[model samples]
Target: MKAWRLGWARGVVELRQSFSNGGDLVSHFLWPVLMLVALFFLRDREFAGTGILLGTLALPSILGMNAAMGMVSMSQQLTADREDGTLLRAKATPYGVQAYLVGKVVSVAGGLIADLVILFVPAMFLVDGLVFTPLSLLSLLGVLLLGLVATLPIGAILGSAFPSARAQGLVQLPVLAMIAISGIFYPLTALPGWVQVVAQFSPIYWLGLGTRSALLPDATVVVEAGESWRSVETVLVLGAWAVVGLLIAPVLLRRMARRESGSSVAVRREKALQRVG
Candidate 1:
């Protein structure tokens, strides 16, 4: 059918099945909640939602973590689709491939946003008096939109690159490491000069910076000249990365498509049987 109609149809199907993974959703959220609890109990004694900002750093940081986690999880789903021959089969139909692709990205993005709600709403009460100002809310939304745009395609590329299902599980460690080095949980100033330099090259760096900017109103206190902590030029960099990521993801998909062997399932099954015998 038509591309638009196909997009809609595929979106529905993808969301239906992808969202059906309720256990994965629970898994995605469980650890973060515990972390939040620790922050509330441990960090709270040290830092109150003092000053004008209430839930600024904590909420945004939580959002940033969700974005990172969501990207890796989304990638694994794509890799699974490939390994199971699901994506290859869908690609054979007119507009089916495009629809499925759109659906995959959209569902993942939606789920990530939903996760933000889950974390923030509960934390409003659970994490002590975390308040939101108009400007702070706008800033949070800005960072979130930019992050969604920037992260979705990167996840797609990684999913395509590491099509092995096992690879998906281990990939988050490196991603979390990038996040740590990117100064999401701590100040970049505390990290070594070389480590900071390495973190500067990461997408999460731009994301963290942008999110922090949204939360920290007093620009001088939050960030200043020559420091990579402020939104500064990271907004432009994030925008550039978003465009590049979306464009490159399709190209990567096309290249992977060329590698399909076009073998029947029967042949693969027979080969498996022969090997077993």
Candidate 2:
């Protein structure tokens, strides 16, 4: 109990540090803005904004960036700590490992939630000249929450998969690939058949589908929506993803810890020391 509370405290500290570092906020808003701007110019032509498609497309991009940041940042940062012996020292104690992991989730996920809200404001404003019902607002919130729940566990698992931060870049390739696979920029209709098949296995597509349903009009065409824009299946899939992610993360993390090495710790420590010196 005390350990969990302490973890929350540590998580809060990380959240603050994440916010203080402006990189996330910029990336979160910038890419989406560029996409929106490009769409704006395209809207002047007959090819874009013909219907609800834009909202559906944009929702996924926001959720994807949020999910990406949480997973990649948390994984790399905590793994860095692990390779540096921070988590190893905790592991020597009874509940230290649990505390650290809890704290990490709290910190990373909390920042992600804030970033989602920040994106929400622009989503409303950016999708202007369109009708937004009360139902739309509720759906948007639902999608955001569902996406958060679903994406965090993926982050935790990835973070714990590698032995150190040096391997983080490699471990994170899947996440980067997810952006392209999930059809954030182009429609999934345009992707090759195999790529689309691979996307179904990634959480990114589910998030994009969910968010698009929440924000886009009922009549808009979605790549995944064979019949309807707001398929109950999207919510179900996202919920399933979230549950599985949460369940699997702890086990994978434990496995990563078991694989930690002494030399790895020493090398990481030396790196941190070099940075400080």
Candidate 3:
């Protein structure tokens, strides 16, 4: 109970810091603004036979992609904390690692929600054919929550496994590729069968699909697999990943935290300085 309170407080402090920091504020707005601009241009363009504007389709897909990017941010933040001795400080305190992990999850998830609002509010005015019934809102919230649960733990594990920020940057390349293949900007049905098969296995694709299901009209599902939203499949696949990630993340995080010490941090700093020089 005490740890939970401390973690929640820590998360609130970090979230406030993100708002107050100029660089962080810009980052929070930049992607949403750029995406809105893209929607502006594509608002009138048709999406093949789906009879929906490209902007309408792209809007929800972009939301899903943004949700998935939370994983990358989590990984990067963890790496940064390690380099700066934040993780070491956590290790020194009682129940600190647990509190730190909880704090990170809360802050990152909260920040993501803020970003979504920044994008979604303006987007509702910009796009056409968007359905916002009570059911749709419920579905959107469900997918967002499930997507976060599925991805963030794996992200923590990845962060724990990687030794440095540079290595973490490398992780982004594959993620970018996954986004491209996942059909965030277009219909997955239009992609080659092999690409489609590979995409089906990716959380990004399911996230996008789930978002599309929530926002797009039932007819729009014509462009999707089986000409349906596959809500059961979305829940199953994301739920499976969530279960696996939850199982593995603690083991990996504990292992990583156990390895942290002042000497290791100093050694990393020395190496980083050498690289900069």
- Model 2: weakest 10-residue lDDT segment is 42-51
List ranges where model 1 is wrong by over 4 Å: 16-22, 45-56, 126-131, 217-229, 261-277
- The Cα error of candidate 2 at residue 14, in Å, is 1.8
Name the TM-score of candidate 1. Answer: 0.81
Residues 111-181, candidate 1: write the lDDT tens digits: 67767787777666654433368977887788788888888888888887874666776778888789778
TM-score of each: 0.81, 0.80, 0.98
Ranking by lDDT: 3, 2, 1
TM-score-best of 1 and 2: 1
Cα lDDT, model 1, residue 135: 79
* Candidate 3 collision pairs: none
Best by TM-score: 3
Candidate 2 lDDT, 1-277, residue by residue in tens: 9889878988899778766768856755675566566555433232144443444455545565565557676777777788668888877777778888888888777866776666556655654433467986677667767777777777777777766566887866767788767767666666788888898677677767666666555555544536455457777877888889888988888887776667768877788678679
Instruction: Estimate candidate 3's alpha-carbon lDDT, on a 0 to 1 scale.
Output: 0.92
lDDT, model 3, position 61 = 93
lDDT of 2 at 83: 68
